[model samples]
Target: MTPELTRDCQTVADRLRATGHRLVLAESCTCGLLAASIAAVPGVSQHFCGSAVTYREQTKVQWLEVDPDLLSRHSAVSAPVTDQMARAVMRRTDEATVSLAVTGHLGPDAPAELDGRVYLAVCVRSGGPGASRDGRDDPYVVHAHALRLHEQLRVQRQIESAREAWQFLVRVALADI
Candidate 1:
């Protein structure tokens, strides 16, 4: 990891520890880089639940329970699909208080418009003072973002995406969201 990314991971770890939040991840184009970066931090096992690398559409559906309609409508790399991926991952693990999902087309084979486009989503469990309200389970509040990488190489794009994910985590963690 780059020094900046390492710092970001550490910052996220520290903030998560302080806020008593645990994290899970769902990944696609960046593969497992985001998970790997988080795992690099010492004692991360306490705050890090796990990650799923759902590279294919089938896996995204089977593993993260990403809706086929959303994928068909927006593609796996779009914001809606990524947001649902985050919510699904968060729901799958009781240990996770926050979930981050990333999907993107970062490749030489990607369509021109989507070649370097990536979508990231962070879902934070909410409902203050109660697990449920009005007899319904608490809902996760999701924050999503879109990014375009300037890198041409697949590896470079992946690295850039990973760095962006870490940075996003830092922002959310610090905000206690």
Candidate 2:
């Protein structure tokens, strides 16, 4: 991992710990990269609950409990699936205060949809007064370069985007909490 990414993950982990929150991740296209980044930080176990690398459609359904009908209707890349992934991970861990989900196509060739078109969903459990009687849901996307490039460059850019995503999640989580 790059120093910047490591630092970002550490920053988010520290903030969540300070806020008395626990974190979890559900990942697809980015595989375990996001989880790995978070766990790399020292003392991550203090606030990092767990993560699921639900890379396959079946895994998303079986492990994350994503709705089969929703997956069949919109495919896993759609917003509903992303939201489900986030919520399911939160439920599965049963310890996370905040959960983050990421899904997308990282391709050497363009996808039917744009490559590097990533969807991120953050779900926060409701607590305290004025917290949503329900939970909270926020979804957004980050677009990164999609072209075929040197393997090193490709990995580098993905790490960069992952760092940015961590930062984005930090801002969102703070606001939500």
Best by lDDT: 1
* lDDT of prediction 2: 0.72
lDDT of 2 by residue, 1-177 (tens): 878888888789778877877888888877788988888888889888878999999999999889999989988877788888888887776667788887766665746564556677877777711244344353222222223222334466467557656876788774444
Question: Candidate 1's C-alpha lDDT?
Answer: 0.86
**Model 2 stretches astray by more than 4 angstroms:** 128-154, 175-177
TM-score of each: 0.92, 0.80
Tens-digit lDDT string for candidate 1 (39-142): 99999888899899999999999998888988899899899999989999988987787889999999888899898999999888784222543534647888
All candidates' lDDT scores? 0.86, 0.72
Which residue ranges in model 1 land beyond 4 Å of their true spot?
A: 128-138
- Checking candidate 2 for backbone clashes, the offending pairs are none
Considering every candidate listed, which one attains the maximal TM-score?
Answer: 1
Residue 83, candidate 1: how far off, in angstroms? 0.6
- Residue pairs with backbone overlap in model 1: none
